[model samples]
Target: MSDTPIEFKDFIRIIGRGQRAGRTLTMLEAEQAMSMIINGQATAEQKGAFLMLLRVREETPEELTGFSQAFRAHTPTSITELSVDLDMGCYAGKRRHLPWFLLAVMLLAKNGKRVFLHGTHEPDSKRLYLKEVLPQIGFEVAQTPDQAKVALDTLGFAYMDLKHINPQLDGIIQLREQFGLRSCANTLARMLNPSNAAHSLQGIFHRKIDVKHRETAALLNDANVLCFRGEGGEVEFNPLRDVTLHLSRSAQQSSEEVKATCETFITKPQELDAKQLISIWNGELDDTYANYGVVGTLSLMLVLVDKLDWNVAYQQAQQMWQGRDKTWPVALPKYNLAAETFDTTGKHYAH
Candidate 1:
């Protein structure tokens, strides 16, 4: 409870003793270890060693659960009070495709389901992050939890950057650049649903991570969670590939994995300009491939949320798309450096 920093040696020794000598941290140990790091008790060397050792040994579901618990403890209660039907984790930047899920989340918000989508992208990321793309549509990524609540109250949805969620968590996540590879931070961050939403959707780049996410969600007793290998590990459903759904569905507060398949609807990913997301949403452009991408993703999320049956969800997704609001914010003459300026200086905002 003191501001004086404690060196991270005690926590590091638990997981980095020696080859075959070091042991995995128990759930309690992991949580305590994470607390120390988040509290700035860990030295830089110990932080890197702890993360690297965990990566080498591979992270267990229990470790991930503890990591997430530590994160949720830090989430501001104001953001948690806002009603979020779904908590979407979008840390994985999309490389080959634009984030169609952005439009999907917006449409779901329009349909009266409050959503809290949050994440951060690497500075050296080759992909376009939602931070950059959301701005084009006049949406400001919330810089703080209170601002996130405002975005939801006024815009019907919220996109929060990782820095706002927990600066310490964000600090560790940024270390990916120095580590030369991702660590457990990416996995645990994706599983963090700070608002305690009943339903969550995770998009993993690898199939193996799908199992870890579902397992961790079940341990957390989440009412519903769906993790699948998505296009570039983002929540967008790829029409070009068969999606293996890794799910955790709860009944009577108990959760279990329910695996399913989403058969590929198209032969390949569509070749379209990424900027067309604007026209696609406004109904000015109608490409069959893109249309299927949007509707299919919506259906999957709907089914994941237990809002509709499989067949009914697909049908309703199409209808929802047809009646979407087409009113557009007047295109800004130039993009601005600050996103928070959206609410005050913009000509218009989502009604």
Candidate 2:
């Protein structure tokens, strides 16, 4: 076998240069790089250089596939027979307020679907993150691959940490601070699908990046991929506008075939105040935001699994949100000020 350590150094050398000299890494090469990243073979300087080079030039579909392959090889996969393996990793890291993915996951999971939410707590701009909000919402954050699997089977919502899933890649979290801007790995990290899910719902920030995300999804052999630029890159529901969705299916299937098999909907943002939004998130509002796009996304999953009609899928989502006010428990655990006080920078929290 090729010496693993030397292989990583060579991989770094290829990516460290500003120019792309060697051939685009094959799936195995990509996997090896990911192994190095997760295993911590690449030094901080090497990591920064590699990420900057890739970000400036962007990665080809093959390179993205390789990176993804490496990511999955190192990270543990949480398997569940649920029809859709939804990954909500929108880039607007943590914002100034509560996380929308937390609410969306709760709503989706309450309806008998399996959801995989993976992210890190590296705070930039603000400290709000799913890691903090999920536990408050009664979902346990898994600290290990085995724990993540058990959580997926039992709770239907599994929050996988990058540090836990892929430690080498996780090591780069602090490096971004030194560079003062995000690198290619930030985007690639979001695209990592360890579950090897056939279907995915990924939120991208920039329209240009969305294009790359779609292309990469195709390269990864995803059966169905929904890529969109959400408000502030927070995959949170915006009831006012239809969260734009770009649908892509594998090359093996015609676009017409996939389009014919899918369902689509348009929704307006439900009027809600900050407190009302939080309440709605906590399943407290009688009719906060219908969260139309989220519903539509789930409906699409239903169509994939059962071949359900669009109307049926829509109704299924409608029914879930209809009486949500009454079904959700009114008494939820209060947010601990002590916990929320810690900022993402590891500094004192201020709100």
Candidate 3:
């Protein structure tokens, strides 16, 4: 190797050159660039410019793939002891509605599905984020990967903030407050899949992000991924609107538009409370919107886990919700096959 060194300015120059001269970074270059940033080799101004320049245009799959590779290389923690079924990314907090998706995840966990979720702590944002919402229920936010593993072992679910997962990246993600626009940090965070789970569920708000995420997942060789335009960019399906679900399985991409099954949409509650999630799950609170949102989102997740058709999955989701163990985390039980499995289909998930 030559006794020469490269600087972060070179990366910024490649992307931030005048419109005609600028071009995207190659996969290798993207990886190196992100590695520098992650290692604190890049200046604050250089990092901001690089991110915003790429954000000005659409982020290419190669860039996302390389960024994700660099991120995973630095993140060595993994729940090797547990087989994680789903990796849920929750960077975009919900604004229009309560996070019904949390209930769906809780129901699946209660019925014995191991899920690992990572999200950002957007302190300045007006929306409600998972970091604050999770504790209101019975769940506690994991401060480290070991804590996350422990949660998965007992609760069948766990959530860690991006700050704990990678404080450097979280610091860059927080730049959104100053930039007034989201950077690629959000996208890179979504693709981490730190536990290397079998399936990944992602939600996006913009028009073509689902496609972008699918392509990036294929580049990363993720086994299965479900990307969709979700409610306020959380992985909760809007039951009142027809939604198109983008899918990537074994690097083959496809999409299907599912019709809206629920006819009514509820206005945002005056006060968003986590106790309501428990109430809805326990049948104490009869919320039409919450019911459809939970069941619909659960049906989508089931499609990822069981590979069932949407209709069949929706039906199964309803059944799962009805038979849920009302008391969870307090008297958590071992995986019960009879309770978790459906009698109609002989397909038993022995996991």
* Candidate number of the best lDDT: 3
Residue ranges of candidate 3 with Cα displaced over 4 Å: 1-5, 79-82, 331-351
Report model 3's TM-score to 2 decimal places. 0.89
Better of 1 and 2 by lDDT: 1
Cα lDDT, all candidates: 0.74, 0.57, 0.80
Tens digit per residue, CA lDDT, model 2, 189-239: 677755556656666666566677777777777777666655446554344
List, residue by residue over 272-308, the lDDT tens digit for candidate 3. 6656666787778898888888899999999988898
Model 1 stretches astray by more than 4 angstroms: 1-10, 251-274, 329-351
lDDT of 1 at 351: 5
lDDT of 1 by residue, 125-170 (tens): 5555788777666677788777888888876788888787777788
lDDT of residue 317 for candidate 3: 91
List all candidate RMSDs to the true structure: 7.1, 6.3, 8.8
Instruction: Please give the clash total of every predicted structure, in order.
Output: 0, 6, 0
TM-score of each: 0.84, 0.72, 0.89
Question: Among these predicted structures, which one has the highest TM-score?
Answer: 3
